[model samples]
Target: MKIFQSTTHYNYDWEHVSTANWQKYSPWNEKTPHVIAVDTLSRHVDPASGVLRTERLITCEQNCPKWLTAILGGDSKSQVYECSYVDPKSKTLTLCSHNMTYADLLSVRETVVYTPSAHNPESNTQFTQTAKITAFCGGWQKIKNKIEQFTVDRFVENAAKGREGFEMVLERAREVFAQERERMEMSQRA
Candidate 1:
């Protein structure tokens, strides 16, 4: 079992980042090699906290590290997960997830939190993703380095793509809010 922690900061408020995570659809038509598709199985909202929970089959393209692919028994299928997006309050939001399909051969539980920056609270969001991995097989040490390096690479790639998608969503949200505000102001003047 291995645990890895990574943190990424975004130059936006927590709400903006959280909203993007929930609603943003990337420009996936451009062909995302690592992520092929996302299929939602079931979802519900927590009335009390307003957290959105979902079960999904995430079709990851066959781009895994060679060693990891070998570990997956050379199967050609996607991974499924049960995930949740926590409600936003003040300046923070959290996303939690657990893997379902690979529970025996592998296990993963991750928590990603988005928080506002202290220095510029209104202008920045801090994203921290912590992932725990467990491999239920022997001979793991032989390919430990490959596993670690691949994990790091994926972390970076995901962050880059996530940032792009989040920014587009946040910008669109701002534009819509601005338009609404202007409309309300004009009506008041009339």
Candidate 2:
């Protein structure tokens, strides 16, 4: 079995970013190693509780994880993630997730937190992502340490590719945020 944990961080607009729905920062990209498509299986926002629940199939268009290909037996490029997030009133949006498709193939989970800097709220928004992936492989417990290290090396490589994609997402989000602000201002003037 192979397993790993990784963290990533980025900055955005503190105020406008918090005002947007999480959809503003889409994870899909046409680039390598990024999700080829985001199939929204289900989505809902509870008006009473101000909670958003989203179920999506994140399909990776590129090559599958080598570990998954070697040990697992099915077409394993896509994974389902169930997410629960709250309103961003506090300039924070935290998402806790579960990988539904990982029932027997591999286990995956992530906690993504978005927060505005307390000291620089007007200018900066911080995004922190903490994620883990554990592949279920038979035997080789004695070599578990080596397996883990190798998986971590692979994970870091994949994460770098993902980061490049997300940076593109971030820049697009910034453009959307600016457009929203311009529209709002124009409406107020009208």
Candidate 3:
């Protein structure tokens, strides 16, 4: 699976924002060998303001490592940012920024678009220009289900294993401590 770097924003306020030039941030630079873009329309109501906002987020993908580190931070693992929309009506640009680490951004549960690989038809290439148009509603459902199941199973298994290992170590330590205490007691009595 080819993993491409991507930047995404979600607007949940009653405003329309447009990006003038994403390239200015140098998001495409670094180790990214391939670049792709996708956009999605969504809406949400702000609980505090009681304002409904429609947002169209354009996600751009790149394979450059340096660019990824600059945007997401660290050595480029994966990242996602839940940003507040800035209504700059003058510039027609919505500003979204987050104070998060690369790992934190990678943990955002955003929609993923899967595309067919051009270089190798058999490969399940995860990035493509066509992803913007494909119906992703159904695919996201499947991906979410699998992720939930896997995460639950992994945590359960690890927790059980950790408890068992801790018990074993505790038992061994108890035995050693008891023996040492008994020897000290006998020497004092003599």
Compare the candidates by lDDT and give the number of the best one: 1
For TM-score, candidate 1 versus 3, the one ahead is: 1
lDDT of each: 0.65, 0.60, 0.35
Cα lDDT for residue 144, model 1? 56
Q: Model 2 over residues 29-83: C-alpha lDDT tens digits?
A: 3244445566767878878876666766666543567776666655656554656
Q: How do all the candidates rank in terms of TM-score, highest first?
A: 2, 1, 3
Model 3 over residues 63-93: C-alpha lDDT tens digits? 4358646764555332223332423332223
Runs of candidate 3 exceeding 4 Å displacement: 1-141
> Which candidate do you rate higher for lDDT, 1 or 3?
1
Q: Name the better of 2 and 3 by lDDT.
A: 2
List RMSD in Å for every model shown: 4.0, 3.9, 22.9
lDDT of 1 by residue, 1-190 (tens): 5667877677767766676665554452232455566778788877887666666666765454577567666654556564655555444566666666556755667787788877777878887878776655567764654554555566567656765666676777777668989999999999
TM-scores of the models, in the given order? Answer: 0.68, 0.70, 0.27
lDDT of 3 at 149: 54
Arranged by lDDT, best first: 1, 2, 3
Error of 1 at 95 (Å): 1.4
